[model samples]
Target: MNLPTASRQDGTYPRPQQLRAHWADLTGVWSFRHDDADAGLADGWAHGLPDARDIVVPFPPESSASGIDEPGFHPVVWYARTITRDDLAVAGLGTGRPRVILHFGAVDYGAQVWIDGAFVGRHEGGHTPFSFDVTRHVTGGAAHTLVVRAEDDPFDATQPRGKQDWHETPHEIWYRRTTGIWQTVWLEAVPETHIARLRWTQAGPAAVTATLHLDGHVPAGGSARVSLRFDEVSLDTVEVEIAPPARRVDVTVPIARLRNGQAARELLWSPEHPRLIDATVSLRAHDGAVLDAVSSYLGLRTVAVDRGAFLLNGHPYDVRGVLNQGYWPQSHLAAPSYDTHRREVQLIKDLGFTAARIHQKIEDPRFLYWADRLGLLVWAEAPGAYEFSPTAVQRLMREWMDAVERDVSHPSIVTWVPANESWGVQHIADEPAEQAYARALADVTRALDPSRPVISNDGWEHQNSDILSVHDYEGDGAILARTYADEAARRRLLDRMGPAGRRLLVGGAPDHGQPIMLTEFGGITYQPDTERDDSWGYTEAADGDDWIKRITALYDAIRASSFLAGSCYTQFTDTLQETNGLLTAARVPKMPIEDIRAAVTGRRKQR
Candidate 1:
């Protein structure tokens, strides 16, 4: 489970796929001010905010890491940072590599940025990342001031504000609002025209297709060279001309393993034996000069549904997943640090879970990078919208596409969850418009990435999905075992409303041909040494012994099921008032880590 990253490379610059060795992290202290009145623009705050306080970059103001841990409703906020002349030199930006790209991993809700008081760009969508080129503003080796404004309306139900609570105070299920910047901000130097996007898809066992997207139209006689390697062994080096009007090119690098026969599966990536092939896609000129290049890696793996089972690399693979809301007590939605990301992934694996369904939030790429490198499977789910509407559909479509496009290159991602438990499309059981929206979530995601399965609605009442995922929290192990004893019994359970009071399928039901997976269950609460009425879970356990007994029974029942392809525990760790997790809010396990791992993997020691 402690497998090394594909490249063991430095994960800087926010964008993990298009990585460059030389870059500057703009994540230290920055000038910050709460523009509650929304008058920062008229007051020329962009020029400079004098009475501003120092707040840490990336971490939102609601998070303690930001140095302003006030969780109040601040609809408008601003941040200012100075990129010094030395910073650019250290990042290797200059003539030839004249372009300096300012990248923001993510900004909540809406954002507008300025450099030297010049409006550089504006972008919306809280969970998706965006960037801009500011070389003109940073000319002549001089320092430039970068200012940003972010607006997040807490009460806007149409917003795809995942777990961010609209209420003034966070309540059950929803967490605090993450206003302004909640991810990394950095600077990287690139050629005038660089490989803006890179994607690797294993269309067949023998060949891997690479698609490179250019930021700008390539010069007439430009060519792109793609080199592939596995375990330090070269596979192939293919070059294609970047002809005009075509900003995209797909180069198929024939993998040697396929031609070797029988050894073709050697490079297939799985949780146990995660093997990654290293690659470097370089932008070359007509004269064969390398204009720009990026280092990346991909796993030759495929995930799909094959006749009532989830297949990985064309074989049935059960996805033993755990729910991860991606929340840190100190950092909230923002990851505490990169090491924290690694630890979280490692901890989940230590519990014997192979995959994690990132509950609502779209996690940062660094986390996904580690998941890809460390061999933990991921189900990338979009944040839920409380209510459905025209605006909500539009917002989700745009942002979900952005989220999918950004993380599609990661081989660790095996599923795309666009909607979950009908949070947005609540009336999809009958409503045509809502059903259409749910169907579109699946269709559009497939159009973007057909390599993985799409769980349009994850929990129950699934509109369009590859697997029949249900959530049942029946604490009584005996009754739960009886409910899904076999295929017929499981079908009867789905014929009625699910534990969450939603139909198993809407606008017509599952034909029962897909694999069944219990996505959520066993939220057993156990608060050892501390007791509070406000804190609760779906079911309560008396003590550490009781928690272990109850969790073991739950896993035993799941393992006994005859129709389950896999199952996911309620959650990986506790968050705030939610006391139902294998680990506590601070990540302290309630029982022995080994015991939890035993129950999770059904690897109980002999009595």
Candidate 2:
């Protein structure tokens, strides 16, 4: 049967693992209405919002890609769509009493989902995926009304807003706010007992440890089996007896055995050679009848910080990274298409950068998938809250946990940054409570994924961090070199500058033994076209030659530091008023692409 897929621009789902599965994409035109007074529930709009106009799904109303092209702040927005059983059947789902799950890639702030006017579930946190089982509310060969209500308060300092502008207009570094559904919505069919979550971790370079979490009870005398394969070649098969009330099962596979006496390095995953292993997990009854099956993939790699160096697969790996805000000119926070993400990753690789600090945004899963497939290291960072109140801390911690859980499976993500430059926890250097909070976040991240490094706060005042990072946009390369000439001089300058200077290094003053990186620098402003008064960068350059000269000098300063392991340029593309990007907002190169690549790869000397 020809499966019915979403007519989305990219014609794909955000999660690649779900592509061949029994699922239907619901990301097209939908009835939309703005609720300024939060009166949708009071007025019984969940039954149907017939008067609402049409707006595309998976794109915010503020984004031009949504077809609304309205960039106003709407605290509440309502969306309504009608789906029939045929719609599910066409997508190869909703058959044979299967459990139908409604999934939302993401909805801004808080979301309430209802099917046929019956409230199914509600979810908080704007950037994480959530789902609800709607089988009871949905009937085969019948029409069902699906309504979604999203409430977002841009000005709420208690919420993690990230770079979304809280004001009515874009200001400073923040851009337009994403209001309603900004990601894909879909439906999937699963068995009574299905695989709920899969966690993969590499044990050394030749062994992989996996944990499978089942969503439902296993039948009596049934067992769970998992098969590992690489390039369609079977490696190992393991089976576990069904245990009552135990929802989790652990299995370890030795990949070296599959190599047949070959070198173990062939199975390792890195930027230069990204190798992935596919797996099929199944739950079988006593008669050997397959009750459930799901397909997933994993990459064997390990990341750690060893003796002031970032180690990837137990080897010292220098991180050549760029700052990516995960924004598009048309879609704002939402990517215009899945291909857009793929192209961005390829472009970063072409630009001679091995890694990208996904700045202040939990990126789309598709982007992380491409990063894994194309081999680009990523530093997953959490959106920031401007305030340090208890509510803000609680909100950030909860949302960050969800974010980590959502992207933990992606092998390309080598580092987890809970905070950036102390944006929300501003008083961490002085306030003991804030310091404790930062440390707690780092601890939580390490506990969640012990294989990867966690940067408590990427930039300054790091209470607990696997890597010591700082953001120094010192325009003059000579001064920057002098500032970090030696460990003692760096500490003296940091202490004298104090916390107010934004240069103070808190939490033990960056011992030379820990991994250090200049996470943000070389924000040379270059606008080839007419420069508006609002457009600004860190330091302005006269032309392409001057820009190249300044950037190369900054790179030289970073390369000269014996303690510094890596550096990330200001950004990959121009975002809003910030023009300090290697590429223009339209993805156009400002200077010669090869020249920029040479500067970043350390192939060219400062001249």
- Which prediction has the highest TM-score against the true structure? 1
Q: Write the per-residue lDDT of candidate 2 for residues 353-471, one digit (tens) a residue.
A: 99999998888888887888889999999999899988998999999998888788888999999999888887777778888888899999888888889998888777768887888
Off by over 4 Å in 1: 1-6, 510-512
**Local lDDT at 578 for model 2:** 92
C-alpha local distance difference test of each model: 0.85, 0.82
In terms of lDDT, model 1 sits at 0.85
Can you give the TM-score per candidate against the true fold? 0.97, 0.94
Can you list the residue pairs that collide in candidate 2?
A: none
Model 1 / residue 333 / CA error / Å: 0.8
For candidate 1, lDDT tens digit of each residue in 91-127? 7687667788888888999999998899999999999
